[model samples]
Target: MTILQVGALPVRKSRGGFEILLISSRETGRWVIPKGWPSKRLSDPDAAAREAKQEAGVTGKISRVPVGSYRYRKKTVEHIRVLTVTCYVLWVKKERKRWREQDQRTRVWFSQEDAVKKVREPGLKILIASLEVRPKS
Candidate 1:
């Protein structure tokens, strides 16, 4: 069975352009967006935002709908599990000095191109590369 997960592509406006936030995974320390299994009580977008706050230490306005989805395989002792992660854009408004997973992971902001290069997931790389941010009206 495929597992469903929610992801947050935390972004912020910068002088050059938009910057994407990425966090190191706890086990592998590889760069990844904030993502986790969905919470039964929270909406998908809200759950994505929650993961962002817990993992990346940022909060912002999150899109109600997912921009895209990606599938990945995760290995466990029993067997390999496939997880489908739906990603939402979060326009980061604030950053916290302390957060829940700060000790377990490191978060950093990277340029769009650089962020694409930092992540190892093919689908996630495509998502980041193809993200089009609209100007505020």
Candidate 2:
């Protein structure tokens, strides 16, 4: 069975433009959005929001609907599994000084262009690119 995950693309509007929050992957040390397995009680978007809080120490307004979905291979103890992650856009409202995974990961804010270059997943890059064209609400 395919594993499902939810991710949050945390963004904030700035004078220069939009900025996105990225966290370093625990194993790979590569920049990525806050993501995790689906929660038993929370909706997908809510799960994504929870992940952002735990992983990136971010509090934000999350979109109810997913912006996109991406498939990737995740390594397990025995083998690899294809995982599908639903991505949600979160407009950051507050950032805490500490979080659950803060010691395990580094969180940084980057410009959309810089963030696109930092993320390794092609599908995620495309999602970030699309954000540039989306009309501000």
Candidate 3:
């Protein structure tokens, strides 16, 4: 297993509730949360935040219960099983138009419920369903 991470769950505020940010991968065009490998210098939340900025063009604070793990098949050299990805909820503050200009990225915001259904893997859906949306205190 390569243990490739699926990325972080960046979200935007919606009329009904918080919405999760999603991006289609450059390679597969598959919808996924913004994520990348853990950076040596950045903390997990910071790393996730960076990914959201780079991939989804959104900046926000990500905080929530440590969402559960999820597994998926990745095409990193070949079809490899990704062991797990730690998911988190991010509060989006800004959207950078420059990042969305990338031909590789197709960013969109969905209601958390919609996003939970949009993901391909069952574990990911479970992980999302497990997410505890913090009350805006």
TM-score for model 2?
A: 0.92
- How do the residues 1-137 of candidate 2 rate in per-residue lDDT, one tens digit apiece? 97889999999886677899999999999999999989889999999999999999999789998989888788889999988889999999899997899899999899888999999888888888788524256
Worst 10 residues of 1 by lDDT: 128-137
Cα-based lDDT for every prediction: 0.94, 0.89, 0.73
- The alpha-carbon lDDT assigned to residue 115 of candidate 3 equals 82
lDDT string, candidate 3, 1-137, tens digits: 35645367876656776777778877778778877787778777778778888877888777644466677766666656556677777777788878743567898887778888888889878877776675453
Off by over 4 Å in 1: 135-137
Residue 131 of model 1, lDDT score = 91
Task: State the lDDT of candidate 1 residue by residue for 10-70, as single tens digits.
Answer: 9998777789999999989999999998998999999999999999999999999899999
Structural similarity to truth (TM-score) of each candidate:
0.96, 0.92, 0.84
TM-score leader: 1
Q: Who is ahead in TM-score, 1 or 2?
A: 1
